[model samples]
Structure formats: structure tokens, C-alpha cells
Target: MDNDPQAQTLIARFNKMKEKYEEVERFGRYHPDYSTIMKEVRVSKREMDMHETIAAYKIKETELQSFLDEISQIVAYSVSDKIMVPMDGALFKDGGCGCGSGGGCGCQAS
Candidate 1:
């Protein structure tokens, strides 16, 4: 992507959101206090959603809708496949790794 200041700023915001979302997801997975941790996760998800909406608005206003839309689709597909689907499977199944990495460090196995 070009080094446009607005695009750079919006990309930084999205990166921050992705990091925060991953942190909350990790906490929700491994925290000892499940109930409290999930509450925090829910709050964080809502905040991320609000930020995404605002970012969409900013992109639209600046005529960066196509750029943002393409990036958003990639991010959404990745998050859905890597995080959401695995989380749902873990909740429903026996909580095994779905990536088939054979218990490697990729799955954070000790």
C-alpha cells in the first residue's frame, strides 16, 4: 500500500484492533476465572466492533472505501477461519488443535 498518511493511520488502528482481539481471545482461552474473563472478552469484542464501524465511516468519507473493503475482507476471512471457527470447534468438540501441526509450537504446545 502507498504511504498515504490517512491509510497508514487507519492501518495502524486496524493492527491495534487485531492485537487487542488476539489478547482477549488468549485470555478467554486460558484464564483461570472463566466467567470474569469471558465478560471482559465480550466487552473487548464490542469495542472492536465499534472501532471497525468508525473506521469504515472514515474510509468512506475519505473515498478509501475500495481499499478498506479489500483489506477488511482479507482480515475478516482470516479472523473467521483462524480464530472464530477454531474457537467454536473448541467449544463444541474436545478442544483439539485443528491445524494438524502435530502438537508443535505453532499451536503453543509445550
Candidate 2:
């Protein structure tokens, strides 16, 4: 299939969002007492909402990726079953299907 510009853009946006979420996670991890941090940083309700949005986006992206991987497998197999098996399919960029040969694209499941 041709490279999808929109999908690529979404992937990039998701990566950036994931990075920002990681920063938030680190902040929370380092300072368990978030009330003090929240007061110091003046974190508003909207800021919390933004974080939640980011998290929801991450979940959506993961589900989308998994769906894409499964669809790719079906398409490939439809073209030629021997060309791609279910054991060779993965939903993430780096994961194994536990098959001996590692023929999959290495996409981890969602």
C-alpha cells in the first residue's frame, strides 16, 4: 500500500503527545505530593484535561495501530496466503508472534 500522509501525520502527532505524557508521568513520579506541585505550577483544571486528552489519544492510537497491523496481514494473505501468515503478523513496530521464524514486521499487539 502507498504511504498514507494523514496516517503518518497522526503517527507523528501521537509520538509528540506520548513524549509530553511521559514528562507529565515523570513529574508525578518524582513528586508524589502533587498538591504542592500543582499549587506551585498553578496547574489548572484545563491542564489536567489536556493530559487526559493526551492519554486518551494514546489509547486510540494504539488501537488504530493494532487494527492496521491486522488489516495488513489480511491483505497480504489475500494476495498470497503463503506470503504472510497470521503468526507472522504483529500490530506494533517491534514485537514477536512467538513463531520460530520472525517473518512478521514486528508490530506489538495493542
For every model in order, what is the number of clashing pairs? 0, 2
lDDT of 1 by residue, 1-110 (tens): 24356555555665665666666677775656656555655665555445655556655765664456556657878777443322222323344544676334345322
TM-score of 1: 0.27
The best candidate in terms of lDDT: 2
Error of 2 at 74 (Å): 0.9
User: lDDT of all predictions, in order shown?
Assistant: 0.54, 0.54
Once fitted onto the true fold, the runs of candidate 2 whose alpha carbons sit more than 4 angstroms away are 1-50, 85-100, 103-110
Give the lowest summed-lDDT range of ten residues in model 1: 83-92
lDDT of 2 by residue, 3-110 (tens): 545444545555555555555667775656555544434433334335544447667877886787788888897898777544322434445544555545553334
